[model samples]
Target: MSATLHRLDARHGRAPSLDPMVQLVAGDMNMVNAAILDRMQSQIPLIPELAGHLIAGGGKRMRPMLTLASARLLGYTGNRHYRLAAAVEFIHTATLLHDDVVDGSDLRRGKRTANLIWGNPASVLVGDFLFSRSFELMVEDGSLKVLKILSNASAVIAEGEVNQLTAARRVETSEERYLDIIGAKTAALFAAACRIAAVVAERPEAEEAALDAYGRNLGIAFQLVDDAIDYVSDAGTMGKDAGDDFREGKATLPVILAYARGGPEERVFWKAAMEGHRASDDDFAHAVGLIRSTRAIDDTLARARHYAQRAIDALGGFAAGQAKEAMIEAVEFAVARAY
Candidate 1:
């Protein structure tokens, strides 16, 4: 974590800690990471090489960790969660690869994207391979319910990607539509990841629903902060170039709000920069200025906080413990990235 993040976390009491949760699930997480490494291996050589580059890129593995932590919290003693976590990660990594292609992104997790190092075709094909591998793991688990949840999430994610593609460079995108897009694109997997823990643990239906709700809300808040960070964070801080969203003309929450509040002249600037592809560094700066002036970032963060609180509240039925606390901190961590 950055120093700035530490300060922000400190202000919120001891409610913002991932360490306790990570430590509690450390053994299971290690097994999940090993499974990820083992599953990435193939005779093609290039497959593991390219996939490992992203897998080892030092992400916190937050999604899979959620799966592991959820199972541990629910008192699961079986090994199924490890495999499930690995499968969850595979699904997520596959999406990242394809997303980088669609966005023409060069950086991910602070490293050059595989699509940049290799060609787009290779990156995309490898992503397909990972998706297939994830399904195989799901089959090994021998649960139609788990398969249905993950498969449905994968389909929803694809629909979200298509929605985002169509919405890009169109400033007329509504906040409701934007939320729908992010909810499907990003939150679906999170919801699946957590919900599957209950499936494997054979928990009650109410517990399963609560975990799904927690993951869904956290995922939405995470994306909201991510969009806000794109307008303000630097490559060193966020692992991707600042203003990449603006450059790509992604009509994220901040952009939607700013465009809505802008005057006619400001609207012209927004249209020219976002729709007409006339954005330069200076124009990007000016766009940031306008967004800040409009308090779009503040509004975006406020919306994110609302979801974060919802995520925290979803754990109301679960007893207070290390895992539950970690899950709550994870929600705060998601929102804190924008700081």
Candidate 2:
């Protein structure tokens, strides 16, 4: 294990939390929130109403926080990051709205999903509106480099969504393919969010690449832990029910690992489950049992720790200070959440 991972694993007494990062960016976040609220408005009442449902809902705003924190790390003192950070959040919120529609998810952040309450078409159209708004913010920023990064990220996220949709309900999906899906879907925006901060700060390309690496690795670790939590956390804790992925037949990392490591009978069960033949409460319980017995969750978490270490190491060029500490702690928090 890397020294950072060892230190993180040794912190059993006090679990890592995003509080430090949140506090670090609190002042900047207020301005970003203002920009978000102002830009999401529309002459059509339904647009803001639906958009606000999820935006006003209690998301941790992690992507925007990364933008602000990265700017802080580069010693940037300008107000440009506030608007760009809001743009990052708009992209993220738009994706969540679309994802809940695609996944047929009923709950998010422990509340009814926008699609469930307002219907799928409304949710989808509002998501489109948010996407347009994000582009407007990017255009207004007037930096082609920033625009390219975020625009490319938006396209990559859409491609990733389609890729994942095509790969859904296949128990034989390989770990490598799964990684590619998540790299585009989740990590693309993370890398763009952090990389754009360096752009606005007029930092060099090396710093931009470093921040991109940090965000990319952290995003992969974050999604891996989230996949693991689907089998371990309840709606109250994770804002979604335990076994939601299993019920939906989504081939997340845990399911992939368990299927790869199972015996003949276990493999049959997995194939049937992914084919939607077995979806009872008892079946989910059995799936969890097989996962535990196979040590899939443990090894999945191990993989997350590996990426989390890389994320921390990516910041090595930055000078040591509160921004660096909070960013490292944020990675720790991402990997620690499944515990």
Candidate 3:
């Protein structure tokens, strides 16, 4: 394990639960949940059915909580945050729907993926419907600024997906390039979600930007831990097959690092397994051995810790309180997932 992770383990024992952050915004979250169920409703039974299945599967609901907690941090007390929170969730859910089709996976959040149950066509189309509904919510807010931030994020997220597609199965993918991919694909929405809270609160540009920075760094850390854990986590723990990234030829950070540090024979192993999509159980075992031997997972967790610290530092300007502390704790909660 990385020294940083070791220190954290000695200090905290384990990752703090997200419950404190959830409790901090429970009232607002209730409103956001109501709006989510209400907005997801449609006359077409299939649309609601499919969307509801995924929604009912349950996620951490952390993104919208960031939106709510951020607004509270800025002392905003308006109902607009609720609608905006729901819209943020809709955007996230829509992306997950599309991503499952793209990744061709069977599980999400410990349940069968929407795409697996409803088929890709229904999943993709319903995802589009959610995208449309998100836009409608933004339009209802009547804030061009909100629309611009979210719409821009929506576009950048799609671009990030395409970027990942381009980089997939390419063993030569660089760390910098991988960071760029996750920044847009994952962090862009996080940045937008938090930024809008400040926007609704009419806070200063500095505060908005600070919150955006917090979310951006936190999102990056979150994805990095995700990549690292996928190498070791079980199907039950990770909610997807272990080595799914390898099976799909995804050039995530861990694989990229392992490839870079591996000997000539190991490089050839990665190339053949990735290119041919022929990673058998033995090949997977070998890959894990290489990753552990090279300290790739340790290094990946180290980088995630770096971003998590940056996320906490970004909240320095906020007053010390529940909102700020919860946000700070969120940084720990995000990075500690690797353990």
TM-scores for all predictions: 0.94, 0.96, 0.95
All candidates in order of lDDT, best leading: 2, 1, 3
Candidate 2 segments whose C-alpha is farther than 4 A from its true place: 1-13, 233-235
Clashing pairs in 3: none
| Candidates' C-alpha lDDT | 0.88, 0.91, 0.87
lDDT tens readout by residue for model 3, 87-142: 99999999999999998889788788888888999999999999999999999998
Q: Write the per-residue lDDT of candidate 2 for residues 200-299, one digit (tens) a residue.
A: 9999999999999999999999999999998884535777688888989989999999999999999999999998988999999999999999999999
Give me the candidate number with maximum TM-score.
Answer: 2
Query: Could you tell me how far off, in angstroms, the CA of residue 110 lies in candidate 2 after the best superposition?
Result: 1.1
Clashes of each: 0, 0, 0
Question: Which candidate should be chosen as best, given lDDT against the real structure?
Answer: 2
- Which candidate, 1 or 2, has the higher TM-score? 2
Winner of 2 and 3 under TM-score:
2
How far in Å is the alpha carbon of 113 misplaced in model 2? 0.9
Q: lDDT: which is higher, 1 or 3?
A: 1
